[model samples]
Target chain A: MRPFLFSKSSAINQALAKKNGTTQYIAGGTNLVDLMKKHIAEPESLVDITSALPAKIEVTAKGIQIGAMVRNTPLANDAIILAKYPLIAKAVLAGASPQIRNMASTGGNLLQRTRCPYFYDVTTPCNKRKAGSGCSAIPGENRMSAIVGYSDQCIAVHPSDLCVALAALDASVKVQDKSGKTQSIAFTDFHRLPGTTPERDNNLPANALIHSIEINENAFAKNCAYVKVRDRDSYAFALVSVAAALNLKDNQIVEARLASGGVAHKPWRWLEAEQYLKGKTANAATFEAAADIAIKDLRAQSHNGFKIPMLKGAIETALQQCLNR
Target chain B: MKQEYNFSRRFFLKTSSALGALAFIPKGVKAFYEEVKNFIVPKKEQLPLTVSINKKSYAIKADTRTTLLDLLREDLNLTGAKKGCDHGQCGACTVHIDGERALSCLTLAAMVPGKEVTTIEGLANGDKLHPMQEAFIECDGFQCGYCTPGQIMSAVACVKEGHTKSVAEIKEFMSGNLCRCGAYNGIVESIQKVAAK
Candidate 1:
């Protein structure tokens, strides 16, 4: 734990520029605080960027453009977001407690890490932490671990409920770099852990700051939602979850964009599942077929073997709700 | 099946507030906090600040490490905002900043210089209590009264934000403030009572 200076910046690029690889920009501090307490994030300098980012939420022609600093409560209550993108609103509301969502930012929520208990306790050997360190969750308490995105190197789950919904919605993340250059990364690639190196969560450099996130206008997404199964009722991470967007034609599934969580290193887009449902009735058989195809490659841990069933049930329920709606 | 941590913290606040006043964690919590503190000893800095609280402007110099909760209780000698958990997980230390209910535990004192702050003490006009505060008392909205200030602050904001439509909406909006006394049924009743007027 090194003692470092704390800097306040209202400019995202300037705050990122202050990063010497040992500094992290504080957005809402919701994720960072837990990591800091667990000794996982030991950055000496914290650049407070909340003041610099405009906390704006507006219905743009493209979709909803949520500022980096916009709190979840307002987003959950935003009349437009609630009406037009109820999935986003529901996802935002599903995260943790009200205190967490209040202090949580749009950018930070998208960047939140997996809640694998092994990932937090520094003593546990984790591939996501020290490269090549064997995954402790392989044989440890991994009931909440990933069943999709399973590989020899890493298999921890993604934590963001909102990100999964955004992934299905094809959301874009706006970023500003130290050089004041701006870029946008689509939600599919916004978070990555193809594991060969698990430490690099996103494609963004340490000197790049997230600005805002834009959820694309997908008619199917407007009718979507994020549903989670967790150990507890409140303030707990997901055990298995699904973010689903579906459009039906004459009571038959015409289009579907389903992404699953608590089952992957990132929001695992069930494209095979969605493709299977094309021109099919959104009944139990169709859902079961998609769920079966979605987890075909999964090889979970001894404790997390249940995730296969949990994630499958989650997708089935989410898709059914979409069909019912 | 996952072990049930089914006990909701919101339910805890709905029923109890004062009688169950103790640290939420086990005895191991002290050691856990100390270990975390060893990792988070922020390099301290100093700054001068002036801010109005409960109608009086408090002029003071503060270390950047001081949180709004610390400033209120330690600096201004206003101990109404209890510090149940300094980590922003609990809403024990809540105050109104420019009419918006905010967590004082997570708020930096230095960032509040220009804001008009209001604590539980300011909710009364002369000898008259604010309608929400009076309703809370009348409905026995609190058990221990420890989370009363934060609950009152959130209740005031709930009405102001027009979250009085349904019990679920009010619960969703007011979820930020945790009441360990579980006096939430009465708390909601109190808010419903004042919102009726």
Candidate 2:
């Protein structure tokens, strides 16, 4: 049964402040409500954080600071962000159907749970739920599972397309606490695994409010863009996705950063591959070597074994496209 | 008790008869019934949300169980927004909050207490329609008009935000608002017209 619920963003923080661990904060209700209907998430006392937080997208000294409350459409069209951070715009555009984007936030996008079939099926014995419980998805139907940085416990891919962009951008998140204290978490370290506790998807405690995602002014800022391969044109998660950024100096690769989504438990970064890419004259061959390194030693579930090559191809193709553009 | 028993018996028979007749009902209706199971089954808890629509304010209570789309159409009598999907998958119930396009279906009524909300009903200058409404009608931007309000709202924002640099740019920006009517030609034309002036 769905939980008896009350929704107040402030009340959510207050309730979290008062309670032990029995409430969930809601934004947009796109993912949470959908899961609730599927009987995947049985949240009691849903604290609606939609109205409580102010939505904004601003240019800061560090870089672009997008409030966690700002919707996808605003971010996708923000003039400075679109021109300065086209990867964010492209990534936001490539996500779930437009209507869902209208409701989904960058913070909620990062905070989005996995889209695993077994995870949603309440009857399934998923390790992401009860630690040490066998993961039905690992063997049963993991065609859409991870291809990199995976563990035995869980292989479900992060569903947010926008998160891949933020990860590539090396975005930092600011979260407000119940006591009104604020703390910042790096984009990559924000999401955790279902390891023994596969249920815990994010590092944010119950009372923490995701305030903003601060994009760092890195060398890859202007050159990055997101590309995905999905079953449908839009609204579906990727079979393989790539967020690639390149900075060329003197016709040689001065810097390159690559991150992949829909193919990992977290936003899988290719730091080794990126290091390999620097000081090389970028071409399809250079991208191929880096992509190969990125997918090296990946643990793929049954259906996802095909994703490694697909991801490599996707990254190479996206890199070439950006270079050409 | 006798009359009550008769009413119960009649009710059961009526239900059975309806079920019998429903054998010819479409598969979609059966699926709809199955999908609506949660809506009918009330959980242990619910909360009150006092909200305002158009310009008038309401102090009514709502189920924490309700979506803003249902809260508006079912309880509040503002049926301007249509429910294409209870999921945020569709932009049928898109409305304006402080002049920005928002999906009402994805929003909960309890969430918007002190904010100003403007639905399709409130998008007129004394029955003379907002420029977007008139432009959409003149350009035939909508076919069914079901997704029109959302399209209009998003289109206005797009132009105001100055995303009409090129057709590709407009398509990319407006990609969030879908018109299954295949009226992209008109939709683009309408936005281009508004954006030009």
Candidate 3:
């Protein structure tokens, strides 16, 4: 790792004031430090913002607000999350190891880079690592590449489990700039499709710090499930995951939110499928049809054609599990 | 001429002796030379940090880039935490920060000033071993022992966090600490033993 200066601040405004092109912010240091060690990231200086941001999980009149610095472990085990927003808790627990969850921050989890092999290797050609370098995953080992919302430049899928749940929950991210000005960005709009600029993972403006995540109270909390299919039963990245939330009335679906991971550049969701489920009876057949609509536009790579059926089954299963309880 | 000759001979003797003694200088003097060298070609950035570890405070000048794992093992000589996969993949460098398990290798030394860091070395009281340590020994929880310290630290946290209720729970919580020797059976048994108490 390269030698760099480290500074810490307890004030968000003061920390953001020092933000520049070469100075990166450090919180939890789970993903950033690993990237630094691999030479994938070489910032000239690191500003430790772990203490600068609020770490509390607050309940508001509209919904709940989770501070950016809140660690994953506490967020997963929080009483409110377990009782009311259980899907978020389940997704958090399904993602990483216990130690990682203890150290990873909510903001850092959203800002984490993709787990694409080429992006991490640094030697391989990856448009996400360095734009226009060419995407190796398109022609190389791409069993885990994105099957939807991908462009010719990049085929990497977003690797965040929590983001998928947040997408399903219609969560919004609140960001503050250096001047203390704040703005709320909807969760789906926050992460960007690879497009031509895979290097820019999200729509977050440079020098803006994520302050908190706002999740409004919803009826889908009780009937929600996050199903993750991975190589390992635990401590592994999802091969295809689904976060399914439904609002039901007398065996009929009143509303639905379905999002998938490991399928697209962002948390993959189809409004057409979500709209199709409304007023429909909650059963395996309806869910299978919804799953079919969700994968209608999916274009698979050479090795990831299996994901089409796998994701379809996962979607149906997630909705079925949500109906069980 | 004889006086001049004596002065020149004395100067030559002093210079020669100083040059010859450089090879056998003490370690402290050699370290000072290194400082002087760094002053000429400055590459390292140093910062003063006071960290509390195992209920003891240490004030040391650390390189700004030094991680907590490196500080404990390399600087402080507390080698219990093994540096397996310097990245966060392997849990061999697990330590407790404020009673929560964290990957020390990913934690920069600078981030730990105001926190309490407990490692495997601090798990015992006086000459008595911690119950987790005793349980590990009784159950033969390790073979190679490289990952034992980290596994023990995580197991202690797991039990405290109420995650040791079932065999599957123990296995899931302890999945971060990879034992390449496949000593998982005994490790799980050890956690169960301690949790049962």
Docking level for model 2: acceptable
- Per-model TM-score, in order, reads 0.82, 0.78, 0.91
Q: Per-residue alpha-carbon lDDT of model 3 for A1-325, expressed as tens digits?
A: 7777788888999899889998899998999998988888888788999889999999999999999999999999999988889999999999889999999999999999999999999889999888889999989999998999899999999999999999999999999998899999999999999888999999888979999999999998779999999988889888899999999999899999999999998998868999999999999899999999999988999999999999999999999999875
TM-score: the better of candidates 2 and 3: 3
DockQ metric for all predictions: 0.16, 0.27, 0.53
Q: What lDDT is obtained when candidate 1 is compared to the true structure?
A: 0.78
Clashes of each: 17, 2, 0
What is the C-alpha lDDT profile of model 1 across A1-325, one tens digit per residue?
Answer: 2344566887665676687877777766767655665678777777778788869988888778889899887888888787777888877777776656667788888788777778877887988877788888877787887776667777787888888778888888998887888889988988886468876677775667788888866667435767788875555578877888777767677788888777778887988878998899877888889988888877877887787777888888887787655
Candidate 3 clash figure, as a count: 0
Each model's lDDT: 0.78, 0.78, 0.93
- Candidate maximizing lDDT: 3
Fold similarity of candidate 3's chain A to the true chain A, as a TM-score: 0.99
- On lDDT, the stronger of 2 and 3 is 3
Clashing residue pairs found in predicted model 2? A97-A235, A194-A198
Candidate 1's DockQ: 0.16
